[model samples]
Target: MKSKWPEKLRKGLHAPADALGNLFVESFHYLALFGIGAITAYAAVATFIEMLEKGGISVDDILLLFIYLELGAMVGIYFKTNHMPIRFLLYVAITALTRLLIGDVSHHKAPDVGLLYVCGGILLLAFAILVVRFASYRYPSTRVIDANGKDMDDGKV
Candidate 1:
């Protein structure tokens, strides 16, 4: 013997509780994302002020700022779409390696094994970006929008 009600109506009995739980989880997620965005913005401003106090900005400083900006942008994008692009992460890695290489060559030391390693990392990340781009072009993802305007993947790729 089984319940006569359809699943939706049967589950509707606990829908209030389920909705409350979901609301709590969603609120917590929004709060965490806002906190991260706020902290990143504060850090970016602080870095700018520090650079001003130092009386000048260098290429490394600019690159660091770009990293911060990219991080903040990534957070915003994630908050909006709930999706993150892998290429953006690769871009961040490439920029960071470039900054590290520049800092090591001019500020810290002459060309060394560490510099070589950083250059190698940059090259690797660049290749990864190219591969990802090629894959996206060759094997495109088919997205269908649901009634709610959310992208539902057809999983064709």
Candidate 2:
């Protein structure tokens, strides 16, 4: 007796519409990336112009600009090389947190509360850095090579 499952599977696997759908999906990827890049470029330039018009840029403003620059750079690198350096995100987050803390301190009326928030933000940043370092040390992206040139995944030194 022939099985009904294999007959159905063979018919479904060779469907012509699936191939055409994949082509459209791939084309959309490039269009989306280009749109995102254009938006980011416009924002970065506009921000720089506004900062210049203000006569002087403050540390908080500089930090925010750096965050935007890093974001654009990260997107550029991702498209160029299909890999993202996680450390770049970490740096951006640190800078953003620093900017938030600074802005909070400058504008807030209560010194004690501002100081507490600043300290908390710093502590959180330090902890995140430590976790990233530990993870990298334990499971490095590059394989460890022996004298014989065989790559090893084992973390043992």
Candidate 3:
């Protein structure tokens, strides 16, 4: 006689260890997401305070603001989609590092060779990320289709 429970459900019920492991993994993921959001919020406030203190805003400062906005948007997207796009985070980091280097250049009297090298490395990484983002946009992993599996050419998907 077949049991009333579905096979998949029955299997899961039989493996309490697997279920606990999955739960722990999911809990950790959420905890980390919250931690990142908290840190980003603090950074955004700090950046705004510094901008106010400087009493002058430049293109690079504006870009730093954009980076903060992007970080918030990333968190929002994660909440909405239950997935975080590493690409978005990479873009934010690139903008942030660039802004940091620009600000350092503007405020410091002496040239720091170490910082210049670090900035160069950040620029290279940003270029790589931009290339990857362009390639992904040009060739998506999956095509969106309608209910009947017809490709939706209107870009709605």
Candidate 4:
């Protein structure tokens, strides 16, 4: 005759605890995404307005805007698809490096080994992106989205 009290007690306590933990996590996730999206949007608009006031748009400003756009897109995709694509971040990084290289060359006007390093870094990042794309294409992952738009990655009923 085994006592069923311990099993019942454990189940009674664990279910609500797990549900509360998930609730907190979901709340933080949405709040963080909203804050990031709002800040990125604000920065992009301020940059655009500043460029308008200056009466000219430089390559650097355009690149900055592109970076902000990518950030916002990443956040949006994460919210909708629940998956963030690494390619967007890579694109942002490459664009930022190009902007830096351009700004440096325009100001220095001299050949520098640092420029070679920047170019090498850009090439490496490009290769990494290529690898990621190839792998993703070759081994596509399947996501099961229910009517509620949540990912069903786990095999839980």
Q: lDDT ranking from best to worst?
A: 4, 1, 3, 2
Shift in Å, residue 125, candidate 1:
0.6
Q: For residues 7-99, write the lDDT of model 3, one tens digit per residue.
A: 888787779988899999999988988988888888988988898999987878698778978988898899888867777877887787777
Q: lDDT: which candidate is best?
A: 4
Relative to the unseen true structure, what is the C-alpha lDDT of residue 19 in candidate 2, on a scale of 0 to 100? 79
- Looking at candidate 3, the ten consecutive residues that score lowest on lDDT are 148-157
Q: What TM-score does model 1 achieve against the real structure?
A: 0.80
Per-prediction TM-score, please? 0.80, 0.68, 0.58, 0.89
Query: Candidate 2 on 1-157: residue-level lDDT in tens?
Result: 8789988887788675677788788678768777877888888888889999998888987897898788888888878975776777878888987887778778766567667776787788778878988998997787679997776767554
Best by TM-score: 4
Q: By TM-score, is 1 or 2 better?
A: 1
lDDT against the true structure, each candidate = 0.88, 0.80, 0.82, 0.93
Q: After superposition, how far is residue 149 of candidate 4 from its true place, in Å?
A: 13
Candidate 4 lowest-lDDT run of ten: 148-157
Cα lDDT tens digits, model 1, 1-157, are 8766887786886889889999999999899889999998999999999999999999999999998988898898998888787888998899998988888888875687887788889999999999999999999877788887776775433
Q: How far is candidate 3 from the true structure (C-alpha RMSD, Å)?
A: 6.8
Model 4 RMSD in Å is 3.0
lDDT of 4 by residue, 106-144 (tens): 877796899999999899989999999999999899779
